[model samples]
Target: MAKIAYILLCHKDPEAVIEQAERLTATGDCMAIHFDGRASASAFRKIRTALTDNPNVTFAKRRVKCGWGEWSLVRATLNTLQAAVEDFPRATHFYMLSGDCMAIKTADYARSFLDQQDKDFIESFDFFDSNWIKTGMKEDRLIYRHFFNERTQKRRFYAAYGAQKRLGLTRKIPADLQVQIGSQWWCLRRRTVEAILDMTRKRRDVMRFFASTWIPDETFFQTLVRHLIREEEIECRTLTFLMFSDYGMPVVFHNDHYDLLLSQDFLFARKISPDAKSLKTRLGRLYAAHDVTFQISNEGRNLFQFLSERGRTGQRFAPRFWETESSLGRERELLIVASKKWHVAKRLLAAIGAQTDIPTIEYLFDEENTPLPDLGGIQRTLEKRTRHRRALMRMLFDYYETDRLVVCMDPAALDLMHDFFSDRSHTRLLRIDCDFSDSYLIGHARRVGLAGERAPQATLEQLLPTIRNDIANEVDQIRGAGFSHHWAVQERASEEENARAISNFLDLSHETALDIVRAPHLFAD
Candidate 1:
C-alpha cells in the first residue's frame, strides 16, 4: 500500500512545524511543505535546515504571499497540493495541516485511520445553513460587492473578514459552482486532492469566482468535494481541535492544555504555540512511545511571552496587504476566566476570537497538568509558592490596560473581578461555564492515559466533577455592571463553534471575522 502524505501549511515557529513533519515522515509518509512568500527568509531557511537531511521531504515552488482572508491562502494551499500530486503519485491520503498542529494519536494510528477509508474526511457546512451563519454575515459574503482589496487598495482587511463594509457594486454568485464553507483543515485521499486541483485548473470561471471571493480556502475545496464525490463517500469530521470563545476569537493554547490535548479523541490538535516549551515537551514525550524526551529551547519560550504581551496590547498589526483599524482606542476589553478547567478558557477564547477584533487578555492559571510518564528527563514544575504566584498575578493585572474584563470563575481573581465590577469604569465580565459532564469524564480518563494499558488511572476522574461544582458555587456573587458575555465549553466540538458568536459580539469587522470563523485560517493552515 502507498504511504500517507502529510501536507504541512506553515508560518512562524518553524521548529514546531518542521518537527511535526519530521515525526510524521518518520512514520513512512511523504511530506510536502509550503511557506508563505511574505515570511522572512530566515523563517523558510529554518524549515529548510531542519529538513535538509530528510530525503522524504519536499517543498513547493509556487509559494504565495499569503495574507489573512486573501486569495493567496488558497493559492498556497492548492499549489502545495498540486505539487504533492505530481511528486507523490501513490500517496494514499493527503493530510492538510498547519505548523502548530500536533498529532493526538501515534502517526501509525493516524495512518491506519486514514488508510482504512476511501472517503474524504472534512468538516463542511452549506453557506445556506442558517444554523452556522446567522444574520447578515452569510448574505454579505454571497451577495455583496467585494474586491480582493489589494487590487483596489481599499478595505483589504474587512473584505477578507467577509461582512458588510463596502468597496464596489454587488457581484452575483457564480452559477458554475455551488458555494459551501467549512474548516479549511482536512484529510483527503490523494485522488480527491488531484481531482480538485484538476477541476480548479480547467474551470477558469470557477477559479475566477473564488479568487475574488473572500476565504476561498473554505469554499473552494468544499464545493469541489460536493461536486465530485457522493455524500456517502465523505466523512464529516476534520479531527482537529481549535477552540473559540463565545465572541469568536481563538482560545490561545498553553502548557496547561496538555491534559486536554491528550484527552481529545482527535488525531490532531491545532495551534500549539511554536514556543510553548512545556506543552511541546509533553507532546514529544507522549508521542515518543509515552517516554519522556525533549529538545531544550528557551528562545521559543521567550519569544512566545513577548508575542503574547504584544497580543494583549491594542497593537493590531495586519499583513502588508490588509487594511485595518486598531481596537486599542476602544475600552471594550475582554478577559477569559474558567474556574476549574483550562479547556473551558481555551474553548471560550477561541469562540471570542472568531467573532470579534477586540484584543483579549488571558489570565491563565497554569493547571494544565497530568502525571509525567515514568521516564527521567528535565521536568517542568508548575507548583509555585502561592504568595509568589498571587503577587505576579497582581502585577500583571495592575498593568493590563482594560475597558472590559472577563472572569472565568477564577476565585483567585474573584477579588480583582469584583473590583473591576464595582468600579465606575465600563469593563465587562464574560463568564464561561464548563460543566463537569460527560466530556469532562472522558478527558479525565485520557489524562490518566486510560481506556487501554498506556498508563495508570481512575482517581483524578472521580475528583474532577466535584471540583467543577465547588468552583461554580464560589463565583456566584461576582456579576458586573458592564457588558458581559457568557459562554460554555461543553466539549471539543461545541467549544470551537462559539468563536463566531464571540466575534460578532466584539464588533469585529464582519467581512474579516467571517473568513476566520469559516476557514479558521490564521497560519495558512
Candidate 2:
C-alpha cells in the first residue's frame, strides 16, 4: 500500500510531458508538475489542459523562472513537492524527476520495490572530499556568494566571483549543518519529505545561506536529508540511471538505446530526447504494462564494462595500460617519429610504409584528422584527445595488429613529447630536425585557407626560432631519459644521410632504407 507521488519539473516539450504525466498517473499514483515561468505560456497551458481531467494530477500554483546553477531550480522542486503533498495526502513516497526523465520499469515493480525498502534513495557525499564537481570551483562553491546566473551571465558571474576573491569575502556554514553534494534527482520517503518541508519553513537562515550558493539545487536537499536522517536509513545512490560524458555533460538517450535502457535495474532513465518518438513510445508501453516480475538483465553491466575498457585503452589491438612494464613485456615494439615539420614527418612515415609492412600512422593528434574516435563535436573531441593524450596513445598502441608500429607525431604534440617518451624503455624515438621556413608556413596557410593573414607570416617569423629551440630541448630531455633507442637527423642532412639515419634507427639494412627514402610520392606540402 505504498503510494508514490511524482514531482516533475518541466521547462519544454509540453506534448512529451503530457505523455509522461499520463503514463505515470495511469496506475493511480499522484503527480504534481511545475513548469518553468520562462517557458512559453502556451506550452504550459497545453500540458495542463491535457492532464486537467485526470484526478491524480495537479499543477503547482507557484512557477519560478529556473536557471542553470541557480536557486530557482530548487524553488521549482519545492513548489511542486508542496503541491503534491497538499493534493495527495495518502502518498507515502515522493520522487523528483525532470521533464526529460521517463520510467524504464513497470509502475507495479517500482511500487513493490519501494514497499520492500525503508531507506531513502539519494546520492549524497561530503562536498569537500568528493571529486564529483569536475572542472569547477569545488570548495569555493559553498564559500563564495554566487549572485549571477552562471549559465546565462557567465561574465558577470566570474566578475563577481573574482571581486569576492580579491576582497577575501567568504560565508561560513552553520556549525550544525554538514555540507554535502548530490545529483538533483532523488526519491524520498514521506517522513523525509515532511522533515525537509518543515525545515525549510522553520530554518529561514539556512535557506537564505543556500539561496546564493552555486548550484544549490544539487546541494540543498542533499545536505538537509543527511542532517535529518540516520546514516543507516539512507542509501547513497540515485534510483535514476544517469551517465555523463568526458566533458561533464549528460548523455542523451535515443531510439537505439531501448535495449540498453531495459537492462538497467534503475526504475527510471533520464535526459531522453523528445524527438525520440520510438524510444518514448516503447518505454511508455513497458511502464504501463501489467507484468511485475521483470528481472534486471546483465547487459547493462556488460555494456559498461565494454565502454570502460574502451575508455582505458584506445581502439587499438593492444591491451589496456600499454605503458605498464608488464603490458610492454608482452606487446610489440613502438616507434614514435617526432619532427617540427609535418611534411618531413609524412615523408618518413610514407618511406616506412613503402619499405616495411610496419603499420604507420601520420599525425596521431592532428585536430583536423585525428586517429581518435569522433566524440560528437570538434571542441569536445579535441579536449578529450589532449587531456588524456597518453592514455589515448596507449590505446592506439594496443589497437594495432603488428610486431612493430610507427606513429608520426604532430608538431602540436611536441609539448608533450618529453613526458610521453620518459620511462617507456620499450619505445623507440626518431627525431628529424628540419628548418621551419616561411615557405612552409605559406604552404600550410594556403592549404588551410589562412594564406591571406599577414599576421600569421609575422607570427611565424617570431615563433620559428622558439619552435626549433623547443624541439631541440625536448629531444635532449627524451634522449637523457634513455629509451630503447634514440636517433636524431639534423635539418641539413641529405636524403642519403637521412635514409642512413632511418636505417640505424630501425636496425634495417641500408638497401631497404634507401628504397624507403626513394619511394614514390614522398614529397607533400
Candidate 3:
C-alpha cells in the first residue's frame, strides 16, 4: 500500500540510466518515470527497449524540452509529480530524483523512515542565495547592461537572455533572498507537496520573479519551502550519504550502503571513458562511483555479505561499506574489531586471506551477546598467555618490523585498550571509530604512556638538548601565525612527557584536537 515515485531526466547514458531504473523497480514499492531529452528520439528508443518489460517504469508521453540554467526542468518535475499524485492518490510520499541517483535505502526502510519523520526531508541548500545560482544571472544581467564595460564569456549571458525572453522581468533584483540550492533529489510527504503547490498559486508574484532567474530550480521550491517552513522550522537532512565527503572520505555510513540502489542518485559521476580495453568485463567498473577505490572482484564478496546481513536485520542496521587503509597497500598489520554477527567481517577476512605475506587478524567482538565461534576463545586465550603473546608479538614484530595496528571498535573498547597500552612499548595503535562523535579515541591514545626499552619520559633531558632550541623556534612560529593549535617535532625520548604536557595544556585551554594539530612539533616527528 506504500508508494514512492522517481522522476529521472535523461540527457545521455541511456543504458546506465535504465539499468538503474530497473533495479529500483525490482523493489516493488515504487514506480519510475523517465523524461528523455525530447530532441533525442534515438536515446528514448534505446531506453524504451531496455525498460519495456519493467511494468513499474513508464516513459512520459509528452516531451519536455529543458534549457540549460532554466526553470523548464523544474516545471517538468512539478508537472510529473502533480500527475503522479492524482494517479496514485493512496501514495503518501514522493521523491524527485535524477537519472544519476540510485537508492541507498530499500523501499520498505525508506518508506518507514519517511513515515516516521512525517515531514519533508528536502535538504536546506541555502538555495535562494547560492552563489552558483546567483552568479549566472547577475553576471549575465550586468553584461547585458554594460555594467563593467568588459565582454566576458557568453554562456551565462545566453542563459539569462533566454530566461528574460521567456519570462519578462521589468523590476530590480532582490537581495537578502535565500533559496535552497541543492540537488532536485528530495523526499516529500504528500501534504508537503500539496502545500508547496498551493503556496505557489498564492505567491504568483514570487514565482514570476524566480522564473526570470537563470537557475529557477534553486529559486522556486527552495524559496517556497523556506517560506512555508519558516514558522514550523522544518528541517531535512539528505537521504543519501553524500555528506560523508565533508570528512575527506569517499565512503558513506557503514550500515546503510544500498549498493545497486545507490546508483540512481547522481552526486556527480563520469561515464566510463572510451579508453578502457573491453566493455563486457570493464563497463561495470567504469560505471562505479569515482570516489570508490575498490575494484569489482574485491567488492563483490563484501557487497554480497552486506546485503545478506541487511536482509537478516530487515534492513534496520543498514551500514555503508568502507575500505581499510590496507585496500591500497599503504599500511600493514590491519586489525578489525566488529560485531560477531556483522556480515561484512566475512568478506573482510576473505580480503585479508588474499594477501600474500601480510598477517591480518579480525577480532569479532560479541556486542549483542552473540557467542563467537571457537576462534574467539582461542584468540582471547592466546592474548592472556605470556608464551603465546610473546611468540606472536615477536613474529609480528619480525614480519612488520614496526607494528602498524588498525583497531575497529566502539568507544568503550577503545578506552579500555588505550588504557592497557598506556604503559606498554613496541606497539603503535590507531582506532577507526568513525561512527561516533568526538575525537576521544585520539585523545585517549595521546594520554596513554608508550612502552619499550627506551623510556621517552626517562630520557627527555638527554634528547631535549638536541631539539629544545628547534622546539622554541617552532613554538614561536606557531604562536606568531595566530595558530590556536600547533605542532612541534621533538626527539622520541620526550614522547610521554610531551603527550602529557600537551594534553594538560589542551584540557586547560578547552581547544579541540584539530586546534592542536598545528602543534605537532610538541611531539617527536
Candidate 4:
C-alpha cells in the first residue's frame, strides 16, 4: 500500500529515463515526469512509449524549456511535483531527481524506511552564512530582476562576464523569510513537496522574485521548505552522489568509481553512460539503503567481503575513497575542525588538495553528522561523532605534532581551544566568520537557550553585534594566549580570493597559488 511519487526533470536521454522510471515504478512508485520543452518531439514520444504500459506514470502538461541557470528549470520541477501530488494522493514520499540518476536501493527498503521516519529528507545549509556568497551565491540572484528567454539554449550565456551589465535587484529580500540554499536533488515527504507547491501559489511574489533569477531551481524549494518545516524535522541531506572533475564538470560513471559507489550507501548515483548499461543490468539490484543486498557480481563478492570485514556500519561508515597526505611524503600539519559550515571548508580543502606542499591534513567533520563533502574526486572521511566539541578539538591539537597546525572551526570550538594552543609553535587558526539571520538562529536560541558554539549568554537584542565581536574577541584571545601564527578571512570574499589568501599564508608558491582560487559550484549536474 506504500507508494513513493517520483518527480523527474530531464532534458536528455528519454530511453534512460524510461529504464530507471520502470525500475522505480516496479517498487510501488507513482511517477511524474517533465521533459524539457526544448527537447525534440521524438524524444517525448519515446518517453511516452516507454511508460505506456504503466498507468502510474503521469507527464506534466506545463512542460518548461529548461535551461541551465534559468528559472524555467524551477518551473519544470514544480509542475512535475504538482502533477505527482495531484495524481497520487496515497504516496507519502516524493523524490526529486534528474534523468541521469539510477536507483541504487530497492523499492521495498525505501518504502519501509520512509514509513518508519518522521523527518523530511532534504539537504540545506545555513543561508545566512555570508561565507557561502563566494561559493556561487551571486549578488544578482537576490537583488536583480531576470526576464525569461533572456538568451537562447543553443549558446551559453556568460552572466558572470556581464556582471556589470546584469540587472540589479529591484527590492530588498523579504524580512520574514530566511534564505537557505543546498543541493536541488532530494527526497522529501509528500507533505513537504505539497507545501512547496502551495507556497508557490500563495507566495507568488517570492516565486516571481526567483523566476528571472539565475538557477532558482537550486534555492527555490530549499528556501520554501525550510519555511514550512522545522529545521530539525528536515533531514537536510540527499541520497544521490554526483562526481565532479577537477574543473567541476560531471562525468559519466566509469569502472574507476566502482569501489567509491559500493562503499557509500547513497540510493542513487548519476551521469551513468550507455556503455555502463551492461554493468548496471548485471549487478544493479544488490545495493540497498538500510542493509546489504545478497545479489552481486563475481568481481564484487570479494570486494564486498573486504568492506564487511572492516566493520562497515551502513551508509555512515562507508569506506573512504580519497588520497590522504600521508600517501605522499607530506607531514601532518593542517587540521580543519568544521561544523555545519562544512561546505565552506570543502571549498578551502579543494584548493589545498591541489597544492604540492599539501600537508597530511584532516577535514575532521563528524559534529552534526551531516553528509560528507564530495570534493569532485575520490572522497574519504573518518566518521567519529563527538559529544563534546570543545574537548575533541583540544585532544586533536595535541594529538598531532606537526610543524604548522591549521584550524578552521566554529566560534565555540575556537573559544575552548584559545588557551590550549596559545603558545604552540607553527599553530595557525583560520577563523570562519559568519552572520546568521534573526529568525532561525535568534528565535531558535530563545526556545532552546542558545547552547551550541555562539555566546549563549547574550540575549537576541545584543546578539546581532555581539556575535561578530565574539569572533574577534576569540581570535584576539587565542593570539594572546600563545598561537604562533594566525589569520582571519572573510567568507563573503570571492572563493578564489579566499583560497588565494589561505594559499599564500600556508606559504604556497605564487605561480600556482591562483589555482587555489577556484570557481564556485554552478547548479548541480
Candidate 5:
C-alpha cells in the first residue's frame, strides 16, 4: 500500500482550497498546506479551522509572504514540504500542488499508478540547451543576481539587471551542480524527497546561490533532484496537464473545458478558475467515482490544431460553417487575381468581373494606387498599411459587405499574396505570366532609378531570369500547400483567348466569356 502526502502552496480562495484539501485526504492520506503570509488573516483562519478536524492535515509553521517570480515562493514550498515530512511518516510519495489545482482522476487510481512506478515524475531538462524559457534572460538568469521582484517592482528589477550587465558582475554555480529547469509542480518518491531535504540541510552555499536567482522556484528543486538521482530514475515530464499562452501565462480551465479536462490522461490539472462551479462539481464527482474508466478524446487535439493553423495564418474572420454553394455563402469567397504586369492583372480582374456579379477593384494593395484613405504622407501611409495589412483587408471586406469581391494585385506584393495563399478555404489566386518586354523593363528601371555601371536595359536583362525563377518557385510552394491556383501565360494569347481562359479558370459561363471579348477597353493598356 503506497500512501501519498500532498503539499499544497495556496495563496487565495480559502473555500476552494478547503474543498480540494478535503477531497485529496478523503482516504487515509496526509496533507501539508502553506497559506501565503500575505493573504488576509481571515482567509487563513477559515482554512485552518475547516481542516482542523482532520487529523491527517497540517500547516507549515514558517509561512512566507510569497511574491511572483521571487525567492519567497521557494521558501514557502520548502516550509510546506518540511511540514508534510514531519507529520506523515508513513507516506511513501510526495506530490506538490497549488491552490488552483484539482484531481481529475480518483485518488485510488493515482495511488495505484504511483505504486506501480519507481520513477520520479518531473519535468527536468538542461537549462542552457532547452528553449523552454521563451522570454527574458536565459543563461543570464543563472549567471546574474536578481534581487528585485520582477512582477511588482519591474522598473527596479530592470535597472538592477542593466547595472549588473554594465558592471559585468556575475555569479557562478557550484562545480558539483549542473543547473536544470522545469515546472514547479512535481511528484517525487519518498526517497527522492528525503534526499532533497537532506541536501538543503547540508548545502547552504547552493541554497544561498539560488536565493538570488530569478524564479528559483522553477529551478531550485528541479536542479537539486537531478544532482541526487540518476538519469534513468527520473521522468522528464509532469503528470499535471498544464498549458501556457503565447504571452507565457497559464491558460485557466472553465466550464466550457469540462470535456477537455476529463479526456486528458493526466491525474491533475492546475490554474482552474474559481468561478467555474459547474466544472468543479463534475470533476469532483469523477474523482469520487470508483469504477469510471477514462477515455482520451480528440477535442483537445482538434483545439491545438485549430490554434496551430491560426498561428500560421492570421486569425480567421469568416465562420467556417458559412461554407456553402448558395449565393449568400459564396459571398465569403475572396479572389486575388495577380500578375507581374499591372495592366495584365487589371485586364484579368475586368474579365472576371464581367463574368460574375462580384465587385472588382484595381490595384487595391498597391502602395501607390490603393483606394484606402491616405495617412498624412506616402511613407507614413505605407508603414501603416503594411503594419495592419490583415486588419485593412478585413475592413475592406466589411466596407464592401461581401468577401466575394475580386481585387487586382501586383506580384510585387508578395506578403499579401502569401496570406491569401495560406488560407485555402475562402480565398483563391490566379497568376498571369505576361511578357516582360525590354521596352517596359526600360521604362520600369528609369522610374525606379536603376543607377549602376550598366545601362537600365542591361541591368533589367541581367535580373529577369532570377525574377522569373523566384516567381515560379513561389507558385510551386502555393500549389504544394493545396491552394486553389491557376497559372496562365498570356504573352502570346489573343484578347479573346485570354478572356476565355480567365472565364474558364473562374468557373464562369461561356456566354460571359463572349461578353468579356466584346468589351475591348478591358484589353487596352
Candidate 6:
C-alpha cells in the first residue's frame, strides 16, 4: 500500500524546519515537500539541502505568500497534494504540518492509523453552541453546509448555528459532529482530501463562500466534513486531544508555569524550545515509538550552532534575502558568530556571537584586558562553576529573541538549560546548579600532560562519589557564615533545603517576579 505523504509547510527557521523534516522522513514512509514563500534563500537552501540527499523529499516550485484569511494556504495545500498525488500515486493519506511543529508519530503508525477504515484525525473545539445569537446567525452552520454556495440560503443556517439558548435552538450535535473547528494542521484521508479538492475544482461558488468566512481554514474543510456526515457521506471523528500554549515566554523565568502544562495528556503541542528541560521532562513522559519531535527557532539565531554542532562547518553560508534594520546586512551576523577566537574575552565573544542578536550584550570581567588567569586546575573548576550561569545566558538570550538554540555540546547542560528557558509570563531570578553533570571541563587537561586521554572519563567516574560530599561541605561552609551569597545545588539535602533550593533556583533565575501561570496537562505520566 502507498504510505502517508508527510507534507511540511515551512515558512522560516530553515534549520529546525528541515531538521524536523529529516526526523519525519526517518520513518521511511512519508515523502516531504518544502515550499518557501518570501523566506530567505538560506532558509530555502536548508530545505533544499535537507531534501537533496534524501530520496523521498520533493521541493515545490510554486511559491505563495501565506497570509491570514488568504487563499495562498489553500492553493499551496492543493498544489502540494497534486504533487504528492503525481509522485506517490498510491499514497492514501496526506499529513499537513507547520514548519515549527514536530512529528508525533512514526510512518508505520501513521500508515496503520490511516489504513483504518473509520478514522479521520481533526482537532475539535465547540463553536456557537452558547451565546450564538450574539453572532447573528439564523441557522446552524452545519445545516447550511449544503446551501453554503448561495448567500440567501445562509440566513436560516446562520440562525441555527448563531441562535443561543433563547432562540429555541437547544439541539446539541454530537460533539464530534458539532462544528469541529479543526486545526489547519491535520491528517486527511484520501476520500476526505479528494472530496474537498473535487469540490474546489467543481464548484467556484464553494470557494467564494469559504473566501468570505471568518477563519477560513477552520471553516473550509469543516463545512465539507459536516456536510459529508449530514448526508451520510463519510466516517470520521474529530479528536479532542491536546491543547497548545507557548512555552518560552519571558515571564517563565518568574515561574515555570509551562512545565505544569507539559504534564497533561496532550497528543500534540507546538512551539516548545529544544532546551526547555522542565517542559521536556514533563513532555518526555508522553514520548512513544510514534511521536513528533520539535525544536524552536531562536528568533533568528543558532543556525550556526546547529551547523557547527551537526558537523556542517564546511557548508557554505547562504544569506537569506530579507529587509533588515542591520545596515551591515542580515547575513553578517552569521559570519561573525561562525569565526574562531584567539583570546579569552574573544572566547566570550565567540559565545555571544553564536547568540541571536536581540538586545544581546556581552559582560566581561577585564578592565585593562590583561592576560587572563588560568588558575591551575581552576579553569576546569570554573567551567563547572559556570554551567548554570552559561545556561542562564542562553536562556535569557533565547527568551529575549524568542528563538531556539541548537546546543553545540555537552548533554550535561540539558536539564538546567531547559529549566532556565521554560516559558513564563515574567522574568525571575533562578540559581544555577553546578552539580548537574559529573564531568569537568578537562579538555585543556586532556590535551596536555595534566590529564590523560582517559582522564576526563576517569575523573567523571571518580567525581560521582564526591559530588554530594563536596556540595555538602560547600553548603556547610556557607551556612556557617563563611560565605553569605545565596547558593544551591540541583540535589537538595532536606525537605526545607529542597524547597529553599527550588525557591532560590527560581529567585535567581527568574528575571521578573510574577504569579506563575499554568497550562492544560498534555503529557501523560
Best-fitting candidate, scored by lDDT = 2
**Best of the candidates, TM-score:** 2
Q: Compose the digit string of candidate 3's lDDT tens values, residues 84-171.
A: 6665566777766665344433455555556666666666665334453322234443212211101121333445556655676345
Give per-candidate clash totals. Answer: 44, 8, 42, 8, 0, 52
What are the per-residue Cα lDDT tens digits for candidate 1 across 421-477?
443333444444444565565565566464443433455556556655555665454
lDDT of 5: 0.71
TM-score of 3: 0.41
lDDT (CA) per prediction: 0.57, 0.74, 0.43, 0.58, 0.71, 0.42
Q: What is the TM-score of each candidate against the true structure?
A: 0.53, 0.61, 0.41, 0.52, 0.59, 0.42
Worst 10 residues of 2 by lDDT: 322-331
Error of 2 at 251 (Å): 2.0
The residue-by-residue lDDT of candidate 5 on 1-525, one tens digit each, is 788889898876788788888888887788899998967788999999999999889999988987667788898888888888888989998888987788887777887888888989888888888887866578888889998765344446788999999999988888899899999889998889989989989999998989999989889989988999998989898878877543233555778777787788688898576557898888887766787777876366467457646754757443221122211122256677777567766665555554444556677556455544222232136565555555445444433433355777766676676665555326666666655555665555555565344565566788666555666676555445554555453556775676666565555656776676555554344
- Candidate 4 runs further than 4 Å off: 128-137, 148-170, 283-525
- Please write out the lDDT profile of model 4 over residues 346-425, one tens digit for every residue: 55554554343232233443333332233322123333322233233323322221124444455455543443344222
- What lDDT does candidate 5 reach at residue 189? 89
Model 1 C-alpha lDDT versus the unseen true structure: 0.57
Ranking by TM-score: 2, 5, 1, 4, 6, 3
Evaluate residue 7 in candidate 5 and report its C-alpha lDDT on the 0 to 100 scale: 87
Candidate 3 local distance difference test against the native: 0.43
Q: Per-residue lDDT for 390-487 in model 2, tens only?
A: 54554444333233667777544545555455534356778876655657755555565644555555765665565556656766665666555777
Question: TM-score of model 2 relative to the true fold?
Answer: 0.61
lDDT tens digits, residues 1-525, model 6?
Answer: 436776776666676666565665665655656564745566687678766887667756577655433445666777777677667666677777664343333344445545554445654344554332232233444332222222212233344444544455343333333454556666666777777777778777666655544445665665566655433433333321232212222211102424333333232345454434555444333333545443333222243335333443445343211111102111111111111111222332222222212122222111123222222221234343243343333333333332322212122223332333332322222222332233333433343354577655767565555554654454343345322223432322433443454334233223211111111110111
